[model samples]
Target: MAFGKSKNRRRQDAAQTKEAVKGAVRSHGPGLLKAILLTGLTCAVVWGGIELRRWALSSPTFLLKETTFSGLQRAAPGELLKLSGLTVGQNLWALDVEMLERTMAAHPWVRTVEVRRHFPSSVSVEVSEHVPAALAVLGDLYLVDEDGEPFKRLQPGDTLDLPLVTGMDREDYLADEAKTRERFRQALEVARAYAATEPTKRERLSEVRMAPEGLVLVLADGTEARLGEGDTDAKLQRLSRVREELRARGLSAGVIHLENRARPGWVAVKLSSPASERSGASQ
Candidate 1:
């Protein structure tokens, strides 16, 4: 009887051990499988990416693709392309777009530039140029943009059809000139006003001399208009009214004084004496 009891106890103990082992395996099995699956997926993704990049770089057709440029005239295409530090047969995957754009913007005439990779191999460049607004007579001469900031040295004939700004010394020209630039602000306004009336007014603008009295406008016909520093809009309106009235009356004048706009409307207008009459008047 004692031996049978011992045998039953042993059987119960073995059964409990088997159940514990089964339970442990059930809990850990999914975790092991999941880890294996995740590792495999990561390896597959990394390998695919590397293979794709390698294939793209190894393709000869992409390396041989041609690069193109637009809106480039002053600078040679080869020169600008060289500044980008790009060459034929370079792996497109290794190209740095931001660096290329920064390099292109280094050009003096380039106001804005865009650089983009052309798929597998080549790069395309598009550039916007700076338009000259005024010319500053520095030692080497400088081209000033519309904002009155002097950017780069000028070449001969580069400032054709642009207004010439005089009377500023080298010190004023080299400085930022933001405050003094307002001196020409009214001149720009007048130039535009004339242009609105006549497109060829740009050719008529000879020089803008900044003097102690105020701004002076020298027209191509040797007619001078005194434009004071204050209340320019009012002054121009008065000038326009006077011009219209004179034209209606078939009268010609040379200098138009816009200095005083009192109740009496004081203005000075000139008429060129006939060549024969000028001799008699001088005599």
Candidate 2:
């Protein structure tokens, strides 16, 4: 009987110990939660204070500390800066770099423009100014690039020294892209081909006409070469060969025609055989 009573006592003691452990954990749960809350609040306050201090120390506006311009030969730095809408004491993030670049590109002389910010305070502008291939004497004094793309037009002045293209002037050249593109391509090809020739020949070459049949190259001395539609490469090659032969054999000819490859035609030599200034007779 005594043994059974002791066993009952031991079982009760075990149950009590298990309840005590559960109660201890339950009692400390709220305190543990409170400690965690206090720690999080302290961290939040410290973080907030740090942020406030940083905000106070930083400048309200990202002022322009320095300005740089590159690849701008004809364009004045001051003028371009003014046009860019970027100035000292302006907010860095507020500036629209892309819009500014686009605005600058609208100027006829500017071929390409890039605007970038040097964090905190500086803005740098780089522009590739248009090297005018020729001045299209259209209604507007359009400046044509080497690719014959009419980028911009303005009143003529000291800034440009390219050749003048005067023919079939129109106001809608820029708007009528299809027609203009064709004409521009032809002119570009002719100009490039002429440029590849000897210096004397290059100097003598005047204008290229985009005719319906093909392209016609008019020289400074009133002579013209007719190249049929397409296959300009072959025609230019023939002209070069014929020119070299004429120079080697002591001959002068007018209107060297590569229009018909089977039988190349030329006007008779008009001036003295080897005189420097050899003029060709009109056909």
Candidate 3:
């Protein structure tokens, strides 16, 4: 009987230990499942981000479709577009903006180029063209800009009614920009002064020829005015006074020398042909 009780007791202990292990698993199973699901979600998010990036980089939808242009006045849009060498279907990522800018720079009328990409759809180009300040005669007529840059040769179709600036070779102007620009500035200054006159008076100034001594202003009536270097404003003031006096006297001159530094109050005028009277005036 004692041996029988001992075996039964061992059986009871083994059964109790099995029940305890089942209870522990029941308590921890939900927490372990939650931890595994969270880990899997993080992995899926990382994988999705990577795939999206790859798709965007290789997608055909991110192509150059439309091209818009601005700040283009004198430059032809078709010509500038050709200069850029851009096509509608080019991949935006592979577009070489710097090369396009360099190509645009090669255009004679283009002063500056700006190229931009509109993501997923289009491209834009802004071109600043060289603006003509005067017509310079350099073997042939050319459009000279404010910065002393002569950009384009004058075509027969171009307008002919602009102030003429002469006396410098095109190659010489291009070779020495600094020196050429200073000379150009002086000539431009003379034009500005003349342009300030009354509309009818200003229209009479047809040419501002650069001279070894200074400037020679030629009128439409074949009258010439000698404007020596410096004191441009003072000289113009004196010229105005002389013009009033001449108009009062009903006199037209072939040439008028106004570089009257010695007698700042006086002007010398030579009469036109078929007239014998040479005259002088005091302001």
Candidate 4:
């Protein structure tokens, strides 16, 4: 009788376990199916994206048909195109824009460049070329831009009638590029100040010499105006007044010294006299 009762209890426990398992399956089966479906959908989307990219890369519809350029002054359009290595019928999507820009920027005149792809068939490149401001004599003459960067070497047939900047040593430039650029900038500032003040005689302005004492402006007529550091505009104004006065008096000055540290707001003039030297200070 004890053995039969034990066997009956074991059968009841097995029945209960089977029912619990069925209930658990009923609760979680739909969730498991939903999870599998979501996984499949994500995989399909990724595959579709990859295939689309592959098709676009190999498609003939994206071939380059035309290339255009703007803001080009000194750089030739054909040369720029050649430098970029972008030919018609090449795959537009295959072209690396950054690499093309770097290649085009290697041109001496290109200061800034922007390359863009117009969808389906075209590409455009916009460039900003350096504007020649003055000529810098650094061993070999170079064309200095408005920002005081010597961009291009002065080659034959490039005849630009601009102010000449002197006293910058090539060795100094080779040793410290930043210092040389700063010095060039200071000289350019003085030249620009003189041009603004003396517009009528702007063409007569020839050389801007970066002297150790300060800056010296030499005119085409061999007149020298010494301008010490600081108060550039005020000193230029005083020099302008002195120049008008001298012209009225029918006199020429060989050296107009406005840099007198001993007496501020006073100008000393040396007349262009071959016989005798005369010096006078004016308030």
In model 4, the worst 10-residue window by lDDT is 274-283
Among residues 3 or more apart in sequence or in different chains, the pairs in candidate 4 whose N, CA or C atoms overlap within 3 Å are: none
Which pairs of residues clash in candidate 3, taking residues 3 or more apart in a chain or in different chains?
Answer: none
| Candidate with better TM-score, 1 vs 4 | 4
Write candidate 2's Cα lDDT for 96-151 as tens digits: 88888987777656889988888777888889987777767678667787766777
lDDT of 3 by residue, 58-105 (tens): 799987789998998777878877887888888887789999889987
For model 1, the superposed segments whose C-alpha errors exceed 4 Å read: 1-21, 138-140, 157-159, 167-187, 198-203, 210-214, 230-234, 240-256, 261-283
In candidate 1, the residue pairs with backbone N, CA or C atoms under 3 Å apart (3 or more residues apart, or in different chains) clash, namely none
Q: Assess each prediction's global lDDT (C-alpha) against the native.
A: 0.68, 0.69, 0.80, 0.89
Please report how far candidate 3 places residue 275 from its true position, in Å: 3.1
* Residue 61 C-alpha lDDT in model 1: 57
Quick one: RMSD of model 1?
6.2
lDDT of 4 by residue, 1-283 (tens): 9999999999999999999999988999899999999999999999999998898889999999999999998789899988888899988888899999999999989999999999899999999999998999999999998888899999997878888999887898899988888988888888888888888754368999988998899987788999978789999998889888888988888998989887768898888986645555665
Predicted model with the maximum TM-score: 4
Return the top candidate by lDDT. 4
Number of residue pairs clashing in candidate 3, backbone atoms closer than 3 angstroms, sequence gap of 3 or more or interchain: 0
